[model samples]
Target: MVGRTNIETGKVTRETALAAFSYRLKTAVAPLVPCAAAMERLHRGARHRILSKGDHILRAGTVADEVFFVHQGLLRYYFNDPNDGGQERTGQFFDEGIVVTDAESFLARVPAKQNFEALETSSIIVLPRTVLNAGYDADHAIDRFGRLMLEEALVGSQRRASRLLTLQPEDRYRLFVETRPEIARRVPQYLIASYLGLTPESLSRIRRRIAGQVG
Candidate 1:
């Protein structure tokens, strides 16, 4: 739906712009939404970025002083285990229409304990944390926008943690497939397994079971 490249600058294409606009309309504005002024200002402030698969958006232990909204492609939030020879522990996957950032680091102005890597070629809108702060202070609409984004992000993080703790592995896999079919459809099996807090072998077994159950 949102696949377009800029003609001259080639940074933020027209289609992605519309994508961001649509995202704001649906997520920020549509529900309890107000005027479009705040969302427009935020969109204008965004710096568009394109990344290929495997690009590192944020390295571990670095300060994530920016927020990014994905317009196309996918990103994975993860940690590389030094003790386990840098084995990746996938924390989360973010796709289009979603904002991705190191929330704890952004809020606390501290180093991130995790890394953000591109799972596929991605188009994203980057907004500096300082800019967002200034906007929040200056405009009530922007403040409301920020609150909504943060609230959703927090709720998602909580839900992910709670489900992982409470659900069985297969149930987690099922929930993932049910809730985030887009991610499940595109991401590699091992990474999906990692995100589901299961080993690849376990996931394979679960898949087999699911197939049998469905069949």
Candidate 2:
């Protein structure tokens, strides 16, 4: 969502209105921003945890408590489809410099809408939802920042949904790699394949073909 550009023009759109608004709030808010006082206050009670591979950060139907900022490793955001006999697919991969949270749960205070799990051993810095809400209520700047984050998240979801319906499988994989180069390397092939909506065997063949061309 952050680095996306218009496919037709390739022009950088990083300074779009939503991004500017989010940036202003993220840097200006007292308790949620990066000012010295805010940093000190936030660091005082924040918790950091190391999650092993396959650890569930949040499971569907469960309540989510904290928003996680990824410090290291990869995480797969996915869910099981009961109608399809409980098949799982990687909806997205969260990597370093990315914030991974169950947005539906965090925003609505309801059960998680999907499952989040670490694909590899990872470390994350977490701040409780209560802390975020307190900061949001106390600072209009923080509330604006939250809204921007939600807007970006929704845009990303919509794009992914559209791509899944319209793009070819290989094109989807290529676009995913172009967008998330770090994740393309950090996550396993099978997981990446799932995220691209391809079978493992087809993914392997595609990898070999691509490698051959590079060679």
Candidate 3:
């Protein structure tokens, strides 16, 4: 699906087109772009899905066979705490250009403890894990893509752990503002508080302090 050819002809070969398109998608959907051909194959089969606010893309206790690349909108990842009478503890938020999925469920083929829900009306490209894995088996480049993606995922997990372990509520809020401004601007304050490991009341204090308005 990707590549270029003789410049004089001003036409592209299949290989050239695939290479070009795969290169473009790599930054956003890395592992899936094993090569121009593989990526094109997946693209042709890609399904677009729309989710309204509050819709759940995935639920706790269910296996997720799909991973979604956001075309537009926001998603929140959370877990229900039975001990807290089914309160949802938001773990993370994602938006356009982000990949939203229950990675654990996709990788392990087990039920996910986390829930993936739309925070706003959203459009996404759904990629079946089965197709991805089959591609990985067929192409060395695709296999490398999978490995690299996992490495990136691990790094992200480590960063979250570092934040939870070392940063105070106020500092965490500041960091969140700096790194994920869209989330802070769009998501509800209470959900943001849950992500920051604070109650809504604590979040209010943090916000007022940041505004230089706390008494």
Candidate 4:
């Protein structure tokens, strides 16, 4: 059992983390594999990992060997812009109940272009590629799940790319807030600005304008 100390209470919360992981796994996999035994077999080798804020689970130039399911806290997927003095440009934020990974890197066995970093103390379930591959080969439902996950990832990537290329900063921010209000609320303003391809000041102005309109 993997656990971390609760910062406020200074007590290990292993059971809480475990319970969250189990619940999230079931919620994610149950629709694809309704059978209890098959779900168990598919996730047989999944393990828990705890990451502190600023920890990099997957970094640029490294192949992603595992898929992570966020059970608690937040994660950021970003890449450094070489032309902009290696400025970190946020790609996406993964919060509770999200599955995260550099799918291309994991599938192609190539170095990742972006990094996966914990934005806060996070508990995640790690599914190793080897175990997942075995499950995929052995179970038809597991294979379908994998295929659907990859397709979703691809579609999400394309959508993000299109938004960045076509949308105005304010529109981008609005769409982001509309689609992922929880992430917008939880993430730092500057990081959110980066994700939307806007300056912090610009994002602040946009937020103020939006608030004024709402009021």
RMSD of each: 3.3, 9.3, 7.8, 3.4
What TM-score, over all chains together, does every model reach? 0.85, 0.77, 0.81, 0.85
Indicate whether candidate 3 or candidate 4 has the larger lDDT.
4
Per-residue error for 206 in candidate 1, Å, reads: 1.1
Query: Candidate 2 regions off by >4 Å?
Result: 1-39, 212-215
lDDT tens digits by residue: candidate 4, 1-215: 23444633434244555556555544556665435555565456777777889998899999999998787779999999999999989988988767779988998999999899999888777888987887777766677667767777889899989988999888998999899988888889999989998889999999999999999
Model 2 pairs whose backbones collide: none
Enumerate clash totals for all models, in the order shown: 0, 0, 13, 0
Off by over 4 Å in 1: 1-15, 18-27, 30-44, 81-86
TM-score of 2: 0.77
Q: Report the error of model 1 at residue 200, Å.
A: 0.5
Better of 3 and 4 by TM-score: 4
lDDT digits (tens) for residues 118-170 of candidate 2:
88776666768876776566556556666766776789889999999999887
Q: What is the TM-score (0 to 1) of candidate 4?
A: 0.85
Q: Supply the global lDDT for candidate 1.
A: 0.79
Model 2 lowest lDDT segment of ten: 12-21
